[model samples]
Target: MGRKLMSTLAVLSLILQTISAMNVICYHGTWSRYRSGNGSLKISDIDASLCTHYIYAFVGLDSSTYEVVSLDSWLDISLNGFADAVALKESNSNLKVLLAIGGWNEGSAKYSTMASNSTNRATFISSVISMLQTYSFDGFDVDWEYPARRDSTNSEDKENFALLLKELREAFDTYGFILTAAVSATPSSADISYDVPSLSTYLDSINLMEYDYFGAWDDVTGHNAPLNGQSVYFGTTYAEYNLHSSVYGWIERGADPSKLALGIPLYGRTFTLSNSSSNGVGAAVSGAGPAGPYTASAGFLGIQRDFGRVR
Candidate 1:
């Protein structure tokens, strides 16, 4: 009986150790942008405990040189308060915190300019390293809106992006810090912007932005991350064409699977289709509803406003 009990304890210890050390972490945006004046952040209906790790907020990329910058003075608040709070209250010593640089609205042009010069690249890398060291950030997430081509106007910006990633990765390696980038969804976007095989070694992970599969941009309607169908081939579904599909694609192109992280959105996308009957019965949706009804705000305000508390 004693021998059997010892073996069971050993197996349980191994499982617990593996669970504690896993690196799959989820991300959230800056708190001040969505939270009330009291500086509260919550994680919606999702159980915070289930998430292996959490990336507290995105720190915007510097426009002048593509370096990371703190917006709204919330960087200090998070470092001094929130990050520490998570560690203490949760007793999660292995928790990893990342400062995400760049975002959709930030554009990739400045990254273009910064990468064009060796001197500027040096300066930009130094700034990012300093930011990480000061904040004790475990990693950095680059969210360049689009590269290798975007919306006709930014088409010329693609090739320069690969160069930027190369330089950034080399710098990150020397510092022994993890480097990651958020890639575009469509294969066209990925082909044009990322140099996957070469980039894979330099990066710790490639976080695919699997959301925004359908929205007002298109004249028709579609789900954000559907499970199957035509959109699935386009990388639209998380359960179907999601992390597994994306990581496999990268692996086929020479990327390491261990370095891949899947991006999931806590919010849902709503659309107004022209053919009501085609959309199914009672398909008329509105950003603003009738009296005493709720109103719609851009992006995922619902997640931040109501879902980011530490406890």
Candidate 2:
């Protein structure tokens, strides 16, 4: 086993060396937040060139990730608008418009159901692919809230999630379309139940949700994306707490970083505990911090609006 492990490490090192040449794909979160006063949104604030290879707009579907309703749920809102804006900036070239299915609030139940039945699964995939064809989406991102336990959603959903990905990969590959998934940041051997190597064989990339390391949810305070911190926290502050460490963790778990994209949140989490220290410790007052620097309290839309004005 030790000999086999070393051999695997050697191969991974080689893969790593080759992967750096691959583009560093980056994505923006929540396009609905970027609506301008005229109801027009421009993604120039994000700088299309910064996206090494592909850029994706994080779209929410019917308030759920798995329950993908109509394409209008995305096309009608700022998500599609953002895609068009980005596509226009890219000279109508492919920027890989991917609709992320499932989110923090949505669970893997929807995915499980979709994968359980063959006909329903085919219909779902067909609908999504058709949307991609109509709107020219490069691929789809499956964010199943979570697979296996240690967070929200059920552990049993892991296998079903894998099955869905397998089918998606087979279908998408035929047309040269991309298929990526947003996987959990921290996953153990059996904890994930996802065959990483098998998954790597099929999909284009696996975006590790490296953000949200810490939040206001904990009884004790911590950075959301802390490095070398006791536990996961907000803000990708330290080397150990930031995206680098998260990426390393994924690499260690057999995921190829080349096929992995880092998730950066445009929005920051705020705590309003009166007694809390400004150093990002202790408790805070009941008041909430405004989303942006100037705004009183800006949500996703408000912030995106501010960003578009600057662009």
Candidate 3:
């Protein structure tokens, strides 16, 4: 997803490449069930061997109490979505399943409000701990969209976001719960929203959302994730928009390389070409491609291993 955020739904294919073994993290968008036919995915359909970790995308935050709550109690709680997802561990003993709180839909203003105050943060942490315990979640994920990037949030969010992670780290440690966060790929958002060094100190993994360089919203068609920047964007600030720059940008900002998880989108954002012959990168596009059959939505929809040449 872009910082503009097309949808709260993201099938994050995060590969945590460590020195010893490759750890794959997959996100199960629970709402997929609402999609018709094969678009629907339940925990039972997962191949646990393929993933080292599975994240349940989005349980929400309550405005009144600042506590985390399931967005779909009927599916997550009553239907045993939580239990079923965690049960993937049984299929692969090394697999750890966690639940994410906060998404594009959850918005930033409230999280800003919740994180800035010690009393609200405490209440939020307590509820997270309770939910983790009750649902048997191995860990928790924070996908707050952004901390200070929105107009609704203030500058204090940069510091308060780190504090929230610090507090969450302390609480999660009591049960050996792993902590992770999904963050924006572009520096436009990252620079404004994150204190990378401070938050990296608390988070076990920092998942870099490294896709969405271009989407249906664009006038030109481009790679969703290019290892190197497109020539069209060259000499522009957007020239840094690619996997190589995004990852190293974090590393340059003092994030531990080992804790960095490279995230790629498992979806595509298509465009209807104004001139099909010019359908390469930077080609002019009329508008969004076409509505997906299963997703039943208009839009939603990258590159090589050359590292140094990209910049």
Order of quality (lDDT) = 3, 1, 2
Q: Candidate 1 at 89: error in angstroms?
A: 8.9
TM-score of each: 0.71, 0.68, 0.90
lDDT of 3: 0.76
Q: Report how far off residue 8 is in candidate 2 (Å).
A: 39
Per-residue error (Å), model 3, residue 22: 2.6
Poorly placed runs, candidate 1 (over 4 Å): 1-21, 36-52, 74-90, 151-159, 231-248, 280-311
Give the candidate order by descending TM-score: 3, 1, 2
**Which number leads on lDDT?**
3
Alpha-carbon local distance difference test for all models: 0.52, 0.50, 0.76
- Flag the better candidate by TM-score, 1 or 3: 3
Model 2, 1-311: lDDT tens digits are: 11001110011100111124545555433433333343333454444444444434434343233335543355445455535544744642534455555555444455555666677667777877876777666678776555553343444565666677888888988888878776665544224556676667677887665555544443434454444544333244333444556567667767765786655443334544556454455344354443443332322113333344432
Over 91-175, each residue of candidate 3 has an lDDT whose tens digit, in order, gives: 8999889998876777788898898899999999999999999989899989887788654456689889999999999988888
